[model samples]
Target: MYDTLKDTYQLFEEIGRGRFGTILRAFCPVSAESVAVKIIDKSLLTDETDRACLEKEPKIMTLLSPHPNILKIHNVFETEDSMAMVLELCEPETLYDKIAHRPLPEPEAAGLMKQLLGAIAHCHRMGVVHRDLKPENVLFDSRNNLKLADFGSAEWSGEGGSMEGVVGTPYYVAPEVLMGRLYNEKVDVWSAGVMLYIMLGGIPPFYGETATEIFEAVLRGNLRFPPKVFRGVSPAAKDLLRKMMCRDVSRRLSAEQALRHPWILSGGEANPMD
Candidate 1:
């Protein structure tokens, strides 16, 4: 653990600001490589629980680093005042940026979803639940490969078990979570489903001006693909989305199961619904 960031890496311009820290583009002389360093100020974490969660972020990334779709952490440094994580550098554009311009074509959306599901499956198999899954958490690398970033809300599920917590963003959170019920890794599938919807429709399935309204819309579980937005989407693609966003947790498809869906397996070549 270095006492400060400047002692080890050459920090550059701030590339991004996160919930508790700023991400800087950094260069490591020893490796002769560039990386993104997330530097968190310990003083900002006044709540003990928040600090504990922050401490776990890098550990979770380390535990799940083997998967190509997951962001890789190169090093972790900590001091009394700061926690810095050196991570694999990627393209600055996030999935959120891409979708904001317009919805992706079916083939492109399918390709991205496959990679996202693969990452989620790997996390689930490791007994880890990424409670927070959103477009902002998805990054693109230099080669345009999708990478799952940000594990601040992740939790270990204890050997294929379930966990209870009302954690997750309002737009993509599973209905079970809002109900304060014990939930499993399938919650990620729900969030991924929301991403899929946005990729194809350019808007989330649930809508509200406020968090409470969004939560209510989620609990209502009224899933529909507006013809104006979904006209060109394949039937198989819509089928997969329905299964993933299914309100009944028992019926929702797991990430592994979603990988096998016809739309994904066929790479979005499935016939579109007329």
Candidate 2:
């Protein structure tokens, strides 16, 4: 199998690594382009959740794909020891890295949010929910187009529209999720709202030195914008943020509704004055 993989694509050095696999740069002779090959060692999948995600990711990506913002998966290969996924090669830097430098201007942040919500909307429409929606999962291409990646934590919401599990990052997890209640696709909206807050404020709205403290803050559900941090952010943008991050799931904005927000429709130009 290793020899077959070697013969199939011109695999290069490892570009990234995680607990389950290493991402390698490779050239696909068939496609005549560079691609990222994620090779997951089956032996390392120690937990049921991890194993399920490995099986589900490829199928979910295939079902919800062909969207501009979602990362494109080209092919899949498997063997007794490992599974390899051929994917579009994106820039090494993630949105997390980009925001670490400085807060993005409204227009720039709006552009990214537009792409993100579009992808989320598509995912929900396909009955898939991306439980993890952090900036680290968002990638950029050479042309600077946003590509939403990493569906390892995603789940199929199905017709029931409710799922149980305490999954997601502390800073971005929704209140209902923290309470161990059944949650739906709105979990992604809460996470995206947290991303927008970080993009505009350069810090997560809910913060603490420890994960427990962060979780506590999240449960408290106090949404605020410090004057110094949010003075320059437009009111329209803030309104959308509030809607997205609302603790009450019923009041939270769906990705489709968020797309129609004046701030988004105008590319962050609506109500420019704070």
Q: All models: lDDT?
A: 0.91, 0.92
Candidate 2, residue 100: Cα displacement in angstroms equals 0.6
Say which candidate scores most in lDDT. 2
Off by over 4 Å in 2: 272-274
Q: For candidate 2, lDDT tens digit of each residue in 60-99?
A: 9899778999999988888988999889999999999999
- After superposition, which runs of candidate 1 have C-alpha atoms over 4 Å from their true positions? 1-4, 271-274
**Which candidate number would show the highest TM-score if scored against the true structure?**
2
Clashes of 1: 0
- C-alpha TM-scores of all predictions: 0.96, 0.97
For candidate 2, the per-residue lDDT at 20 reads 92
lDDT of 2 at 191: 97
What is candidate 1's lDDT per residue for 99-192, written digit by digit as tens? 9989999889999999999999999988889999999999989999999999988999975478987998989999999999888999999999
